[model samples]
Target: MSVLIQYYNDFISRSADPRVKQWVFMDNPLPTLAIIAVYLLLVLKILPLYMKNRKPFNLTRIIRLYNIFQVVACILLIYMYLTAGWIQGEYSIGCAPVDWSNKPNALRMVGTFYWLYCLKGVELVETIFFALRKKFNQISGLHVYHHSSTFFLTWIGCKFVGGGMASVPSMLNSFIHVLMYTYYYMSSLGPEWQKKLRPWKPRLTICQMIQFTILIIHSLSAFHPECDIPKYFMLLYLPNLVLIFKMFYDFYKDSYKSKSASLNHHQREKKIS
Candidate 1:
């Protein structure tokens, strides 16, 4: 245990981003880990038990506000990511390395990324909301896995590689969230709105899959010898991307493709009749 602690301290001093270490929850993994653990405990156990005998809270207004905040926050993150480097072309989308200097753009990238990290934490509230509303079915393995994995991974990214090529995925994910939360906000208006927005659900999943696919490609491109971003980062990140991509693909297939196939078979039977 002592040797492992020594090694961990050495690793952090050698590689963790010094600038972000002072930021809230960026000082160490403990705070972030605690937050995630609490989220899991509350949403998966405590809240469910608490609500077992109570009526589900009607959080319609709260949901609308949450969705609106998500949309706005995501849009702002996209712009922040752009100004940090991508907009002025200071960073390469293909294989940009982390800038460790105290330069303005570098610091900006770190700031933007840290906020992105915070946003991932904020997203856990969605699951909490689900639990509060007693929408247990919405809290599927895929849903929880996606939320938790992204939160954890983004923390690692901020701690070690706070910017550069990784920023591409952050920006793209924010863009997708803007679209996603917009749909949520509209659907939260009423049953009629949900009916109208229902058709777009599969499209949202496809967009998520596309984002994951792009991240996989982006992670692969980091293997170039000239790119200073550590190869180990890709090693850690790429496999997660592949796993998430596969999960999303499975979800799309199970949710949309099979339904379409079944509908087609029904139409064919009707014609035969």
Candidate 2:
């Protein structure tokens, strides 16, 4: 296992950007592409099998496992981040690089990113569960697009962008997932648990929005003279963020609008009766 980890690490390190010795550990294009391919294939193949049977998919086990996995992963990442800081005697609060070529720090960042990248693959199972349960309507274009795009973009980020700026998003995302997965796990317990946890979904969405906004700002800050990061990469990061923000906003509006309208209709009927 250690050897395999080392090999993976070496593979990513070699693909690091030439200019900055800050190696991109999660950036390997081949593996990412392969993973995406496998995901698509699985979706195509398995979805139909489930559909034919017309059976409800019990996601209790998967959700429980996912919840545990994310919590543990988040803890490990936080520990890694802190350990790296302590060892190097360098730390920054937000998304700023302490130094580029700090190997241990870079490796830790890479490992975290690697897990996150794998998590994207694991997340594909969500769609599968939805499909199996025959909740096809829930599988929106936004759902598919976000899942697919993130897998590729994260790979790109790991490949092209490394160090403090890149690690910031991963760290924040992991923290959010810890909460998000926990909510999912509890809600999976059944309807009784769901009512008590009803408020959590909005909070999760809020946190997600906040995280993206912070990431956008952090990426933008790279253009500052004092920061001295590449301009092209920063520019690339901004437009994607803008699009993501817009998408999330649209989703929130649409989701709430429908619910609000339904409630209003119900109230009008009650008043008339």
Candidate 3:
């Protein structure tokens, strides 16, 4: 155990992106691990036990506020990435490697990556809310896995390569999240509003599917011998990307395709009658 710890500390000291090593939660994995540990303990044990005999809190206003904050944060992230280089054609879509320099734009990109990592940590609160409201159904394996893995994954990305190809996925994800959180915000208004937004739910899922597909392709582009951003990052990241994509695909089929098929069968029976 001591040997392993020594090796980890040495590896991080040598390989971490120097610009971000001094940033909050960027110095080591322990803080991030602690956050995840607390999140799991609360949602899986403490919150559930606390809410067992109590009435669920009506968090309509709180949810709406949180959704609004997510929307704004995503917008800011999009702006940060865009102005940094993505929109100005400064980055290669196929394979842009990290700058790793002290140039102003490069540092700005580092800041963007760090903030995105921080945002993932903040997102764990969504699960906390579900637990507090006794919405255990929302805390499915996919939900927990996605939240936990993404938080750790972003931390790794920021600590190593803070810019380049990574910014592409994070930026695109922010755009999709803006749309998603907007839907959540509108749906939180009331039951009638939720009914009105129902059609958009499947559409949102389609958008998520599209995002993951693009990410898979983009991640693979890094493997070209000349791309220069470590292939191992993609090796670690792509599998998780593929896994999450498959999960989302399953959800889409179960949630929408089956319902569509059933509805079509009902229509056919009505016609026969």
Candidate 4:
């Protein structure tokens, strides 16, 4: 394990952008890991106990505002990514690489990726909101891990590979969130609007699953020795994307497929009775 740790550190050091070396959390992941640990501890253990005997907070207005903010943030990111990296097809789907220099366009690309890292911190409020509402069921392992890992991995992206192909996943993720938070915003309006919007929910999950698939494919392509993207980053991303895809697939199966099957079974039984 220690040998592996040293190799991993060496890999990151080789790939990291020299320009951003001094940024917080850019030099190492230990600080980010510490923050995630505290957040998990609070949400999963301490806070739940504190809220156990207390009334759940009615945070509908707060949730609505958060959803709106997320939608706006995602939209802005999409625009920034377009202008910085992908507009006019500047970045090919599978082959954009880190711009190691400090030109203006390159700096825009780097800043956009770093901005995503910052947003991941804000997204932590998602878990906290669930906790505040006493919606413990929503705070699953998948939820916490997704929030935590994105923060860490994106930090790695911004710190090491901040241009070219680095922007792909962030752009895709922002696009997905635009749809996702719009749905959330509608649902927060109450069951009436939620019912009208219900049809879009599974579509959102499907989009998320597809987003993971695309990331896996794009990153996997970078593993070819000829690609300018670093081999180690692709190596790290491929497995991680596979894991996220599996998790989301399982979620879709349980949340949508299983529920549909159970509902059909109940309908058949009722007819028989």
What's the TM for model 2?
0.79
Estimated TM-score for each candidate: 0.96, 0.79, 0.95, 0.93
Q: Candidate 1: where is the Cα deviation over 4 Å? A: none
Each model's RMSD to truth, in Å?
1.2, 6.6, 1.4, 2.1
Best candidate per lDDT, number? 3
Return the clash pairs for model 3, or none: none
Alpha-carbon lDDT, every model: 0.89, 0.70, 0.91, 0.85
Pick out the ten consecutive residues of candidate 3 with the lowest summed lDDT: 85-94
Report the C-alpha lDDT of model 1 over 37-144, residue by residue, as the tens digit: 898898889999999999999999999999999999999998888898887888876988898899998999999989889999989999988988999998888888
Q: Write candidate 4's Cα lDDT for 1-273 as tens digits.
A: 999999988876776788877877777788888888988998999889989999999998988898899999999988988898577566778776777888777888888887888899889888888888899999987898889988888888888788888788888899899889888988888889989998888889999998988787777778777888877777777888898889899999999999999999999999999
Q: What is the lDDT of candidate 3?
A: 0.91
What is the lDDT, from 0 to 100, of the residue 162 in candidate 3? Answer: 91
Quote model 3's TM-score. Answer: 0.95
In lDDT terms, how accurate is model 2?
Answer: 0.70
Backbone clashes in model 3? 0
TM-score winner = 1
User: Which candidate would rank higher by TM-score, 1 or 2?
Assistant: 1
User: In terms of lDDT, which candidate is stronger, 3 or 4?
Assistant: 3
How far residue 6's Cα lies from its native spot in candidate 1, in Å, is: 0.9
Candidate 3, residue 110: CA error in Å? 0.3
